[model samples]
Target: MPHQSTAPPTRFHRSIFARTVLWAIIIAAAITACLWLLTDATIRNTNQIALERAVDLDLAGMVDIHASGGREELARRIADRIALQPRDGQLAHYLLADTAGRRLAGDLRQWPGLHAGVSESGPIALPGGSAFARATQLGPDLRLLVAHEDHDIDALRRQVALVYVTGGLLATLAVALIGMTAAHRLRTRIERINAAFRHPDEEALARLEKGSLDRDEIDELTRHSSEALARLGRLAGAQRETTDQLAHEMRTPLMHLDNRLVKALAAAPEAETAARIADARLEIRHIVRMLESLLDIAASQARRGDRHGLAPVDLSALALRLGELYADSAEESGHTLKLAIAPDVMVEGEEMQLTRLITNLLDNAFKFVPVGGTVELRLAPGPSLTVCDDGPGVPLADREKIFDKFARGSEPGTQDGAGLGLALCRAIAERHQLEITLLPSTRGACFKVAPQARR
Candidate 1:
């Protein structure tokens, strides 16, 4: 029946580290794309310029031949150039034509669609593959065409694309690795701060105190949190001191008052006077009990704050011993007491506080259950303990409030209690880092107590 602490669920995309890495990769890809486009344009422009130059040189050679030996000489020169060039998987091609567009002597069969100056043409089907051609005219009638294959330019584009893609992938991976490392360091710092809050011990505080001038925002947070805890510790110490001093000062006066009331009860002669004195004595005893409970509460709080006087104790043995001690009392009260204790359940805590914690729970169960009803004490694995009574279960509305000081749920005047028993039980449990919760029952009240560590 122990309650658990709840935390919000975290999504992968929502994490700050994940978001940072994702954005970094996106920016890198965008930059790579821009660079690829720029490089592709540059390569294409350089190839085009080179192709134009080569075509112009060839045209100039043909013009020289024509000026030296007329049109026939130019045709003979073009034929020789074509015969000298290799045809197997050749990227470059050439063609020459006469004034009537009749084939003279060259690689090409006929004139391609072109202008006088260097112009781009397409896929002029050839032996090896398709081509992108640059054509120029040697004269108004004579035409010359030079072409480079499409596959050459395509291969260059593929090579550039491969380089960019590979580089982009490597860059993204590097960014991710760096981001993961940074995130791990950040998470460790955050966990340290959280541990400081949870433990708030001297060691934890000392770790927080070691600060640096080059610290980040997380360090600033750690400093602020440490300061807050120190302030709270001081205030808690002051409060404990005040409570202890007040309890000490009040005890003497209360004892003296109780003694005076006892003397008055003894001296009173008349029955009515003696009865009134008895009532005052009863009230004094109630006040004394309240004072003792308050002191116990303060002591438990102090122990929890400092974590002092802790030792390993056999909880199962302690529970068994308490059950044996209380069995007779239960029978005397006309209630059936039952015990179901396990063996060798060890826990780390102060024996005295743990004893009081269990005793308070049994006392409450015994006090509220109807005469002739059953009260059961159970100790099981996980070192869990439960006390149940076959009496009116606590009302739903009063379940939480019952653990507060001076808060009672039963009909007024029906129970003889000052309403501090459950509150004291809770204080002791908290001191031992235990959890106590009210369990659902079919017939009566059930309370379960167990170590928080087990949960």
Candidate 2:
């Protein structure tokens, strides 16, 4: 009754939507990181090269000016640089000093101690930022130093990194949205195929058989599966038809033979001869019962999972009515029929078939248990019915085997039965989408009918 969930149901965490989001995030992060690394490396190298060139040219020009016109001319050029770009002075260092270490007309607090004589170049700290610098001992008297600040380059790198971050976020969002849409459509298509099998009908089957002209693996699978189902349906229909025809053909003659036996019993000259004829008639009756039971099993099997003719049946009331009807029989057999029935336990099924299912279970219990034994029938909220008998319980070996058609229990008293009762009970339960199981019992055989979900 409780069928398995969808094939795609359990692994939802690994679905297309989830995988797409994960991969999108990974790709976006990788790209953004690579760009940031490249920007930092390239800008660092360019900053170093730039600082070297600017300082080299400034020192060269100062050397020529100081050699030709001494400290007067060199100091004038440094002063012109400071006056033209005051902000530039924050990044571009300038200094000119005499042998006494007294500053000339340039923007420097004091002449810095340059370690590498002649031409010095390396990283140096300045107020508010860091920089790369080059210093020179010009003409052994007037010193000139030049440096370039890196705060502007650091700000530029951060701006580029921000742009990359925004782009990665947008990429992740866009891929996530696209993945959801694709997963929805793909999941819907898969569910459509599952629905056809769950509640198969002419239209759904036909649709599957026709399939899509689209070039996809799922569509191809549907087409192949539909063909298989069609084949199986044809085979099952033929088998049922042939079996029904044989059952029908054999029924009339079996009835006529029984009627003839009855007539012969009436006309027999001696009590012995009449007794023999009566026994024959009894055997004939058993055969007829077996035949009818087989037909019922076959009918129920054919009707399995078909919801067309079903309606809500009050199973509680039905059990109550059957219990009352069997009370007389139970008393005659010196057995107590105890019913612990709940109210309004409804089920979806044919009343006649459900009645037969319960009837067969009751008959099996009554047959197995000896006189003076107790038989209990329970009805509960799950529309669950259980019939248990205080008889020699079914052997463990035959428990599962006994449900098969024509499977007889190996216990001593089981021979008289045609072994169709439990088989028919199983078929009827399945037809109503319920499961009947041989529950574990301490003292007797107990059979329970309920939906699979409860189990």
Q: Judging by lDDT against the true structure, name the best candidate.
A: 2
The true-versus-predicted C-alpha distance at residue 427 of model 1, in Å, is 4.6
Q: What tens-digit string does per-residue lDDT give for candidate 2 at 72-107?
A: 887888777677775743666677766666877576
| CA lDDT, candidate 1, residue 12 | 65
Write down the lDDT of every candidate, Cα atoms only: 0.77, 0.79
RMSD of each: 5.6, 4.5
Backbone clash numbers for all candidates listed: 0, 0
Residue 271 Cα positional deviation in candidate 1, in Å, after optimal superposition? 6.6
Highest TM-score, which number?
2
CA displacement after TM-score superposition, residue 214 of candidate 2 (Å): 4.6
Backbone clash total, candidate 1:
0
lDDT by residue for model 1 (340-428), tens: 99887877778898898889999888777889999999998776999999888888778878888888886654357788988899888
Error of 2 at 10 (Å): 9.1
TM-scores across all candidates? Answer: 0.71, 0.77
